[model samples]
Target: MKTITVKRLTEAFQLEVLAGADRMDRVISRPRTHRPGLEFVGYFDFFPMERVQVLGRKEINYLLTLTVEERLLHIGNVVKYHPPCFIVTSGQQEIPYLTLFCDQEGIPLLRTSETTTEFIAKLDGYLLKALAPELSIHGVCVNVSGIGILLRGKSGIGKSETAHTLIRRGHRFVADDIVVLKKLGPSTLLGTHNVTAREFLALRSVGLINVVRQYGRRAFQDETRIVLDIELSPWQENALNNELEVIPQFTEYLGVQIPHIEIQLQPGRDVAGLIEAAANNWYLKQHGYSAVDEFMKRVEDGMQQ
Candidate 1:
């Protein structure tokens, strides 16, 4: 959600403008910013607004081909260009007029030792993130085989304990304590975790313990396609009405609709077994079978007979 600006770019790197130094401080229109009425000068100008500019050997070669008038035109076009911010690539190339202009105009004149290709590839990522706004949040997730599962409940509802049990039973933990949920596209949900917190699962018996230390790194998973959810709560048979023949449905978390299953918990119950059953039932549904509906059909047929 943070917008990258030209002023921010100037401060990030050592820059030395080759031309149009006077216009260095001018605002370049960023396609990411989506500002109106701005033009960009060169195809190679995909630098981050926050990057330091450096010169490469090839750019000097390009500049030598122009007449003074043509050179001025290119500089003028560059100065007048909008959006994509500029960085001359490579190290210590002389363009005195441009450098002086940059100093005077307050445009960033960055100089680096990296080749243009490498610099562009590296810095372009920052600009892309600035241009394209994506939302990321932290939470815990798991991949029950291919079925992505997310567990959420009150602070002490055994969320981490349940996740740990699943991991020991050969299910992969996507995230343990804190899970990050991101929207991939319309109607799609993806969840992952920070590396530092990925394998760390908390338990009521102790605080946070490292899963990798206890179970090894293989117990953790990078990410998963979240297809189902499990919300742990103290079991209440009376809470669920008879008309509710199916798992209660929920389609939104952090504002996204996902298939959800409310797993009401109680003492002395096999929590891991419940999770396994849920995954298996979901798998059956994925393959076009529904146990509840099938049972309902059998009951109706029996009544008719």
Candidate 2:
């Protein structure tokens, strides 16, 4: 499980720390936050200790109705679980029960300017992206005709060269050598350039090249959802033969399967054009059409006639 620190979250959201400044190094393992509305009402049986608790206007307003000792008892019962932190939203002025116990219990008590709903939504998005399962693979990721494709094979298999050609033909480049694949949802794998080598393409012929400097901004994308994987291998006369593949293939990454294809490379072959065709074909398949299946149907009908 990926974990983020309380200090980083505070810095990212510019949270005003009312207590537990020394415990800012505490780690948050969960990606979601809890409101603790029930816990505030004397229901601590099922309190979540590890989550970041949020005190919105509703919770704070309810706290106003109780006496100071009752407030302390209620908040204290909830704080004994030792939550990662508490975030008070909606621009609230004070919650002494929270501040006093949070400091004593070594919990980070913070405040945000955004409303409860808005802050929760933003925090969810940030946490989803930051805590997503990540993997780095050796390949070239490019956006050909708006279809994100991954070119994979052994080293020096011309992945970069093919991506260079595709970019020259107006396609957008995503990542060159190492592609970072982040699984945000259950079945979605997003591809992007390596952090250290962002937007830089390495070609064997001319060394390292900056994509934006060479091909302008339109020819590059910050990230793309990988929809297809293409494996390129050197063609051998004995091992290679023309084959009609009607059934679609797939490649798995982080448990998500994506459409896949294998193309053999040889001298005088238009690999970039082939990749473009594959992207168009995949787009057609997405729209309930398959040229290969249609061709086989036509052949069967002719044979029967």
Candidate 3:
């Protein structure tokens, strides 16, 4: 997680602190203050966690109107219980006890003349960097029904051409060449295309072109989840000999397991149709139906007979 410091904010905004210069060195995040004086409570809520709190000058005055006991409680909650990075925006207002307590606790107190809006705008990008979701790239992601399908394969295989055919078949596009994968949460993999490279899919003979304009909006998708992984390769005599064979299951992506499938593509095969089959099969599997498994069971019964 990246942190933006007071010095950096000052430099970015070209603003000076009216008070609490000693606190200017504090590193913090963009903390939202619900009300004046309660800003202290918000800071206290995160207690001891390394988070920065920013408050407008008017919010400070609102706190000053509170009873001394209320103010003390806020201070006590933060100073004694929860300590965090504190910042006051639109400076020159003073809270004597707050400053004293901050000094005693060695907590950083910062002030800036910049309005809360301006201050937040400056910290917005940094905050985004800190909050960005993690990503992993193990499977190939294809855009199908606005879903990101990851097609895994060895080099020299026609993954890009298959994707191109899918695009021509009225499916949207995401990443054609390389898909960027990010982990959104537990057991979930997010696949997205590089923004600059998203609109174009590279073929062996033809170069890149904007899929959106060439094939229309239906030819491209914004992004999709990596629900299925189709592994493409030349058909080999020793590779997956049985049409009814059940390959080993893969349930993880970048160490976090997930639902996966491997589809082998060979010469003179309908790759786009196979991809559509994969997508539909995934949907059926999600709903507790496996057409291949059912056929296998029937075949086993017939063999017994």
Off by over 4 Å in 1: 3-139, 194-196, 241-248, 292-305
Tens digit of per-residue lDDT, candidate 3, span 1-305: 43456666566656544334665566644333222344465544533345455667765776677799887776666555333445677665666766776766666565677678777676654454334454544334567765567876776588778888887777767776667776545666777776777677777778877877788877777677777777776776676646664664665665556555656666678988978976887777778998877998999999999
The full ranking of all candidates by lDDT, starting with the best, is 2, 3, 1
Which of the numbered candidates is closest to the native, going by highest TM-score?
2
C-alpha lDDT values of all predictions: 0.63, 0.90, 0.65
* Top-lDDT structure, candidate number: 2
Mind giving the per-residue lDDT tens digits that candidate 2 earns over 103-132?
A: 999999999889999999999878877788
Across 71-188, the per-residue lDDT of candidate 1 in tens digits comes to 6655555444332344666675566545554554456555557677776666654454344323444345888877888888878788788888888898888786677665554566
How many clashes (backbone N, Cα, C below 3 Å) per candidate? 38, 0, 17
- Give me the displacement of residue 204 in model 1, in angstroms: 2.1
Prediction 1 TM-score vs. true: 0.59
Off by over 4 Å in 3: 1-48, 51-65, 68-140, 241-245, 292-305
TM-score of each: 0.59, 0.88, 0.62
lDDT of 1 at 33: 23
